[model samples]
Target: MINEVTRALVAHLHSRTPDLGSWVVVHSLSAADAAPAKDKLALCLLAVDEHDHLRNSPPVEVAGRLQRAPMQLRLSYLVTYFGPHDEAMARLTRVIAVFHTTPVLGQDELPLTLGEQVERVTVRLRNTTADERNQVWSVLGRPGRLALFYTVDVAPVRLLPGLDGDGRVLAHRIDLAGTP
Candidate 1:
């Protein structure tokens, strides 16, 4: 579900910014050592936290079984550009514009892989200080790169059920160190 949110963001960006082409990627700034040095944009999921207010939401009913409530996640991302500084900054402007216009993404706008529980996700540009950004860089053990912090809030995470459609328990595998 987390990755699906990222993919949805990337897909939305690509759909909105045609000139960006296929350069947008899900990457870590620290892993660019061996990658090609072409002009591209990188989206790094810096942190994922549960939405505090909705953490204890009610359970769900699916196929006559009571399932635990969906876990709502807030996904934080850092968008970075690698290559020519000037053009990269211009692209950042476009990104900001896109998000500014459509901060809320409906289920229809997102990837089809999203579960039934996720109705929508909110995107917000977080106001971050240089010190906070630097702390993130410090935690990554890498130098700070130019980045914008965006958070996608309320992405629902629904766990799969143990029983199959036919009311049978799914297979399980347990590996133990010692013989039974």
Candidate 2:
């Protein structure tokens, strides 16, 4: 699902600016750094966390059996520029503009890779302190140049079926306050 979101963003970027070419990609800095391209921007997965919005999602009925709700996740990515500073910055500006215009990707925009439960994905810029930024760069083993931080919302991870039993209120036991 994470890859699906990134892929959707890549396609969106390509569609918005054909002049930018197909330089928008999803790859690790450590891997790409070895064989870097002349003009490219890598959208690297930075982190992932559970989305609290659907903490208590309703059970889904599939094949007459109620299945546990899919786990919702939020993903973070860093758009790092590689190549000449001037041209890269110009392209990054366009990238910002594109995202600014369309920050959310819905079922109409997203590929089929996303689960049926996931209706849409939200993208937004994430603000971080200098120390936090330094920490992230240090972990990635790259000297900070220029990067765009973004967080994509709500990727559903489907869990296995076969819940213990038919989900129902079998019985209601009522106890009086004075009764043991």
Candidate 3:
């Protein structure tokens, strides 16, 4: 599911920023890896963490049946532009602008596979402290470069049946003995 989300996001970025051309690469962050060639960009999924606020949500009710709520996740990514510093900055700025304009990826904008699985996704720029940012890069064994951190919230990724049988209210009864 995470992979699917990443791919869908990459596709969305491609469509939204056609001026950048075909230069989006999805892979793990590696310091040893050579920089992306000119005219290329990379999207490295740095981490996937649960959204703390929704971690303890109650089971969802659907069609008279209770089902376990899906896991709400916040996916982090390092958007890197590899090229001349000036051009790279330009591309990065455009990337920021695009996300700002379309903060939410609606069901229609999602890839077919993702659209079926998720109702919508919210993208936001994450403000990480220098220490946190350094830690992330350290974990990847890479030195941080000119990159932006963005988080995508994917809610309710899976659903589990809460009970076996359907719950129904068959009838209503009223007591009028006193009135009689």
Candidate 4:
């Protein structure tokens, strides 16, 4: 099932990227609370705001001057605006947020059984940047696969039903300073 999932994702990516463009594929396994759905697997894609159309907007400044009877002063004027690149960046960010938080269930290779029952699978965004995370949430609340550019990191995880079990969480929060 994992192999099939990987193939499906690769196919999907191939369809999205044009002949001149490209995308890299990645995979990982870590401790998780739930297994991937029968047909769908959790995925993450990272992207930068490189679209020129949406990111063209930059702060602008103009020269200004004030004059009094005996003194003259000059100051800079400030302007805030949005360009094509900015819009694209914002839209891409929103798309990523939705994909990370939304749970899609189907067929999967991972054997997921909780106690005696066949547990339902769900995908969740454990931790992420605020802006990127919120965008994923918004899209998750809606329907359909999100469209955007993103970098992906995959990890396998074991989900334990109880604290007494031996399954350990492989992913942990770390500070920017490198402290765990």
Candidate 5:
């Protein structure tokens, strides 16, 4: 199931941008009794579009931080879904990031059944071409229909820039309360 969703999303993104790269992520959702991060994730989509209001945008560059607020604004559309397969869900949910953008990764811990895991998946994408950045901004900023789906319950996954002292990639842990 995870692979299927990942493949579908990759395909969709690739279809839109042929020259993009992506990374797969798996999350745990046992601690979270319910999904709370969904709101934040959904809000991000909206932020992306609303933040800058799309002035003369530029193509995506391989090395650069995207205007974070705008991307976050664009992400706000995911709050309405509680399951996968919803139209909005398909467009908003991300288990992998394929484009070229610096990803902001973090997590919180949650209490749950003995060994159950509840998690949220987030993928950040940026345009690799100088022109694509502006084009992506335009696409994300505008109001239109997007695909989305209900997320699966699993371990929370985080994307970090490098590894930590523990020899693990420095990723945040998201729990029921929040990121910790």
Candidate 6:
């Protein structure tokens, strides 16, 4: 589900800025370690944090059956521009500008899987402390490089199908006469 969102963003970026079509790449942080080519930029999904807004929500009704609500997830990504120091920074700047303009992605912009279930997704810049940023690179066993942190929120990832049960109110008795 999350992969689709990432791919959609990459596609959108490519469409908006045709120049970056071949230069932009999306992959996981671990994957990036395997291929450290300095020519292409990468958007790495570093982590995912689940949101608590609907964490405890009860099962929702779907087609008259009770189905579990999908957990909302916040995807963290590290956008790294690779190449000469100045050139990399320049590409990074362009990446930031693109995100700044399109902070939110509507359903039409998402993949069919996400578009059908999620209403919208939000992309925001995450400011990380030096220590925190260093920790991420350390975990990957790679030296720190120029990168920007971003968080993408995806809601209701419904993985389970609706359970078979009767949820409809068959009848209701009125006690307007002050009787229990």
How close is every model to the real structure, measured as TM-score? 0.79, 0.81, 0.82, 0.21, 0.17, 0.81
State residue 17's C-alpha deviation in candidate 5, in Å.
34
In what order do the candidates fall by TM-score, top score first? 3, 6, 2, 1, 4, 5
Backbone collisions counted per model: 0, 0, 0, 32, 74, 0
Residue 88 shift from truth in candidate 5, angstroms = 28
Model 2, poorest ten-residue lDDT window? 160-169
- Taking the tens digit of each residue's C-alpha lDDT, what string does model 2 give over 34-149? 63576888888888888878778888776666666677888888887788899778878988898899998788787765636577888898897888888888887878868888
Off by over 4 Å in 6: 162-180
> lDDT by residue for model 6 over 68-123, one digit each (tens)?
66678888889887788898898888878888999888898887877997878888
RMSD of each: 7.9, 3.7, 7.8, 25.2, 21.0, 6.2
2 or 4, which is superior by lDDT? 2
| Candidate 3 lDDT trough over 10 residues, lowest sum | 160-169
Model 6 clash pairs are none
Better-scoring candidate (lDDT), 3 or 6: 3
- Write candidate 1's Cα lDDT for 89-174 as tens digits: 88788889999999999988877766355888899999999899999888766767777899889667777668432232357889
Whole-model alpha-carbon lDDT for candidate 3? 0.80
Q: Which regions in candidate 2 have their CA more than 4 angstroms from the true location?
A: 31-35, 58-66, 115-117, 163-180
Q: What lDDT score belongs to each candidate, Candidate 1 first?
A: 0.80, 0.78, 0.80, 0.32, 0.31, 0.79
